[model samples]
Target: MFFSKLVMAALAATVLAEKTPVTPLLLANFERYAAFASAAYSSDCANPPFNSTVVRYINDVPTDTQATLFRDDIAQQFIISFRGTSDIQDFVTDLDQVLVPCVAQGIQCPTCLCWQGYLIQYNAVANTVKSAIDAGLLQYPGYSLVVTGHSMGGALASLAAASLDGQGLPLIAYTYGQPRTGNQAYANLIDSAFNGTMYRLTHTNDGVPQIPAQSDGYRHHSREYWQSDDPPTIENTFQCQGQEPSDCNQSEPGYGIGNGGIGINAAHLSYFGISTGNPLDPNAAC
Candidate 1:
């Protein structure tokens, strides 16, 4: 009987040792939405700009079928707190000039001020991360907190990442077509703080990341592209090179673009429905 009890204890210990880290789960959840946004952008390339009412619906009406589905289906996957906010339109309007070509081609435009809202939203998210950490979410030391979003959401994700990094939180953020939120210095600081924890997913020739830098110092990450015909998978084709932790190389492939380039039309839209890669496959390397 003593031997059997010892065997049971060993098995329990083994099970505990084998548990998956929460950090990866959080990162995976972020990547999942990025993949979804990629698909959504591709499918809706021809849709019109988001009107004010549509934006309102997305932000205010949590009970709306689509919003609820997005929250229930996606947000719950990780311990994420989502705050839907307006001002995505303002970002689009601000970058109206450089985004014209992509906008005309039906690619979505990523907005600048939308990132501002994200910064606001991140204050809450940052607190959550702090609370989680204080509560011992990182007791395993391998657990990670993640934040993700699609299109404008992606842009916001980047901002949140920066804020979290400032607070010295361990976070991994995956954003799709996240536009340029600030100057080169800002991007560099974020990259340095987050290290390999930030991944930006972009498709071939997508224009959202191509925003004209306000200064010569502004430089975005180097992108890894997924072939248009490839299936969505977490492979080296989907990672981008940011400004820090030189050895942090990883990849994944997927669809989506946040609108931004040369015009008002491309403003305030999220790309959907394109084929690329799965952001959450454990077997895949990126």
Candidate 2:
């Protein structure tokens, strides 16, 4: 009787913990950082909330490798965020995948064909981030590292995060509109590697997360945070949905495909807690 009572108490406590809301400040910061990741110009880099210094900015135009490294002194953190697809090259990258040696050891995984373009970019950027971390820690002690991106950038961030896995630091990744980066083996590798540190955020009706299609054997990391509103009028509406193959993303009706064509574009651009402006509007037709 006593043990049954204790189990019920513990379950109640867990439920209470899950119901606890995310703070406004953290959500605001995520918005700012995500927007910062999507920025295209040096002028766009002027974010006041962060006394941000751009450590490295790479724009190998039209090939889906536009990434930036910023040291946020205000937050005392380093953010490595990638920008999404902007041209034909990015689309090509999405279509291209090649089988590479599995990242996890002793796992006789199937032939996994990871995103080729993201793999190349991750290799180069991972080295830069490591070097920066080694140097930055001396300059700014106790600073944490955050990896983030949108769309194709998010895919690259996932690959980069996997590469940086097992490093002796608490790493956090927040990716938006990120499509699948690899097969089941790669997804499992990330789950084991990053564990609880990776958060994949998807907005309602967002089509990007639904493809390069899971039917192709691509899978997403667990613990997805879903936004169910358009323009996101309220705060902290994001709910934690655990993994795919359940009722998340394409699994739900009127979300992945039901949003229609415009919905997909809107979902990709809006980061929910962040701005609602379309990042593709300016150059959408250009």
lDDT: which candidate is best?
A: 2
lDDT of 1 by residue, 145-257 (tens): 55555444555556656655555666666665555555444565555665666666544344445444433223454332222213333432333333311111111122112
Error of 2 at 263 (Å): 9.7
Error of 2 at 121 (Å): 2.3
In model 1, state the lDDT of residue 246: 19
Error of 1 at 275 (Å): 8.9
What are the clash counts of all predictions, listed in order?
39, 0
Worst 10 residues of 2 by lDDT: 277-286
lDDT of each structure?
Answer: 0.38, 0.63
* Tens-digit lDDT track of model 2 for 60-146: 543446666788787788877776766667667666655465443223336645766677666655656667766877788799888
What is the overall TM-score of model 1 with all chains considered together? 0.46
Best by TM-score: 2
Candidate 1 residue 169 Cα shift, in angstroms, is 2.5
Off by over 4 Å in 1: 1-31, 35-143, 212-218, 222-230, 233-286
- Cα error of candidate 2 at position 258, Å: 14
Off by over 4 Å in 2: 1-26, 40-44, 60-64, 102-113, 233-236, 251-264, 273-286
